[model samples]
Target: MSTSTAEGRLLRYVDALQEAFAQEMARDESVFLFGLDVDDHKSIQGSTRGLLQEFGPERVFTTPLSEDAMTGMAIGAAMAGMRPIHVHIRMDFLLLCMNQLVNIAAKAHSMYGGSVKVPLVVRSMVGKSWGQGAQHSQALHSLFMHIPGLKIVAPSNAHDAKGCMIAAIRDDNPVLVMEHRLLYGTEAYVPEAPFEVRPGRARVVGPGDDITVVAISNMVPECLRARDLVAEVGISAEVIDPVWLQPLDIDSLLASARRTRRLLVADNAWLPCGASAEIIAAVLERAGPDAGIMVRRIGFAPVTCPPSPPLEAAFYPNPGTVASAIHAMVRPAAPAWQPDPERTRLSYQSSFCGPF
Candidate 1:
């Protein structure tokens, strides 16, 4: 679980995280880790594996069930010159600590007139699988993006995950690192040393001129699938992954939208004043009244998430659905579904387990 590697090891999403934690704790004597089940046998789904034995109880331990009290303790520790990394098994549980996170941790530096800093890292899992239902599965990046002074980092690959985790630990403010549950099994080439993926930047994953398909978190992989499906129909789409949500890189998005003359935002949340809406508004503001850019938003259906598999399929958008949307946008009269649904639908990896 050492962060130092031979430069090009293929690491899964969970492995990248463990390496980042090991490297940071070893580098900074003042850095410590804490959270629910962080040091237990489960090890927070293996992201904190081997850390307890390596760092010992003082540096790595679990907390009580009280999120608000535990969050306050982390904030106090940060103010006292110690970097604290707090882990949440699910982002849904973060709702219990909103007052401390949004009001105190997010506003400390500004309130103290830059006299103090809160170098706090809050890592939470975000995604859906195996009928976990609504309580355990929610991607609340859009919700946190609306609040100021909070840096939200949702890395889509192993490289970005390791880099962003390291960056968040060293940052002088409260940063939220959101990890998708299904992405844990995804493997990619990552460097062995710790690095930083700066916040407020967007990465252009695929290049095209017909449309700009903006995605975040788990939607990134789905967008890649949609790109291939759309390519078969002679549609070229440029995909953009906004790793940092709060201080969004509007410049890159506007550039893509201007060139493509069409934009589609795919977010993993409901679509009422969500991330998709925010992006569309920003693009329109810069493009002006006469701009012919046609904008559309794709997200979860406006209803409570159902438990049935068939209903869930219709609720969540997949590559097939995304490709169909692009087809309809490019040619309004085109059919929504292809000749066969079985061949078009993409499935998740077998390694994905039900919410624990």
Candidate 2:
């Protein structure tokens, strides 16, 4: 489970997350993982596979389906000097524990005047799945961003998935790690040893000069593909992934927007008053009216996600949609155009097999 080589091997996103949990749990005795179906054969889409056998029931176990009660238990355990990682299979269900999360876990340290620490990590999955529909496919991380004392991160790749998981476990505050379901099958080179992707930092995934495309969570890969498509038309797009959402790296976003003067934010959720809107507002406020930075955003079409595959495909933003938006902003006078339908189809529509 450890490697000393300088060049780490490629690992799937799910395996990378499992490694993070295994390493951290071994490093500290207090680190433990608990969630519904964690001990089941499926192991939460195989991310928790082998944890039960390796860590035993005491450290890795399953819980009842009561999110509120389980979340409360985790908060209490964190206050009692143990680091707990609570996994919610879907972000949609987190709403059931808002009181425990917003009122207690997020406010404990401040309410206790810094004497108490809530070292807890809540891992949840977002994004569309096979006909999961509105109830199970919602990405509500933005709701938690408004609360104080909570750190939020949505790692889009395997590397950040592992690094951010380690960082969240080590952090002294309550942290929410939002994982995109489709990204679980993605692969990236990752180190065996534990590392931290510090919060409040943004990575420029694709560097360019013509325009800046700030993509969040699952949207990062789509925007990257859009960048490639736009390149055919002589457009260079600079894509940034704000790994940490609560303490967003607005400075990086502002710098890029200032350079390109045309920015588009693609998020995993709706745009109105969500992360995309927040990011666009931050950039505009700093850039000022004289900066002449034109901004736009794309996300779920401001409606409940449809259960049907075709409707779901239309609801979410794809590379074709993203590229079209970017093209429209950068070339307002150009004729209407879009990427090929085959290329624009939902990337995960065919690959993702899910019952969760």
Candidate 3:
């Protein structure tokens, strides 16, 4: 059900993640939660609030300060018959456990010819500001995207967050769900019960003519705002939200591009060869040069996101930038105004060429 108000509920993304984990744990005894201070509940962003109380310590067990040890433990636990959900406060921290994710969990199914499966869920945070800086603020989903046997999920609103989170827990393959650092308080109308949001499918939020904008995660909200801003200037643009990044919804992209004949990509990733590059390239391959499609990506500038407010203001692409870009893309000529017949009679002779 949709809310009547203009603004949606403000449920934090961490809250959404915690609810998904708890729902799955209660649904299936095979599910278990693991991470640092998961038992603490209120200390870290209050994401794990009341989880330990319901599931108790066994399911919501805490880990020592060892990424390698716990990562290996999670992989072994998954292999030995336990669905362990590993939580990282920040995604950049996962790099220390890359070997376990890429080598063991990712390669195990293929190495053994599908004899085993690693149904593990790894949830991490990607913070750009809030003083987290380069170490903690990096949106490094591309790193996991490089690995073959990984299911990458990044949901924009509360509904997709819940749906994708439940889907990740049920997935037989390794799933990495990245929670945008800034979207913590963002919320939408999520189904009351657990739902499955199939991977590789994109959701078309708004339908329009002329242009199709492919947005990812938080980019979805930005696109919506941009759509409204551009509409004021008389250009209608469709917005597509790709919930799943890896098994991307190329079909939706192609369909929208073919329909609109123009594409504007908005993503959190940096320009050049990020996910935007791949999406744009796919359109070119399918439609060719005469497809009448032109793609301009809105994302973080080439420079890094410094903690400084001014630098970040310029670096991050907001709705204003998207709106401005849309205006430039569709620069309509102003309508010609006519004067009263009596007043225009004199001008008829002189107005032939006013400049002359």
Global CA lDDT computed for model 3? 0.75
What tens digits encode model 1's per-residue C-alpha lDDT throughout 130-168? 786787678787777888888998998888889889999
TM-score against truth, every candidate = 0.95, 0.96, 0.86
Give the distance in Å from residue 1's predicted Cα in candidate 3 to where it truly belongs: 19
Q: On a 0 to 100 scale, what is the lDDT of residue 211 in model 2? A: 93
**In candidate 3, what are the lDDT values of residues 181-259, reduced to their tens digit?**
5666666665566677777878888778878888877677777877876776678998888788878778778888888
Estimate the overall C-alpha local distance difference test score of candidate 1: 0.86
- Candidate 2 lDDT over 144-182, as tens digits, reads 998998999999989999999999999999999999888
Candidate 3 — worst ten consecutive residues by lDDT sum?
347-356
Which residue ranges in model 3 land beyond 4 Å of their true spot?
1-12, 332-356
Q: What's the CA RMSD of model 2 in angstroms?
A: 2.9
What is the lDDT, from 0 to 100, of the residue 15 in candidate 2? 95
Please give the ranking of all candidate structures by lDDT, highest first, separated by commas. 2, 1, 3
The stretch of ten residues in a row with the least summed lDDT in candidate 1 is: 1-10
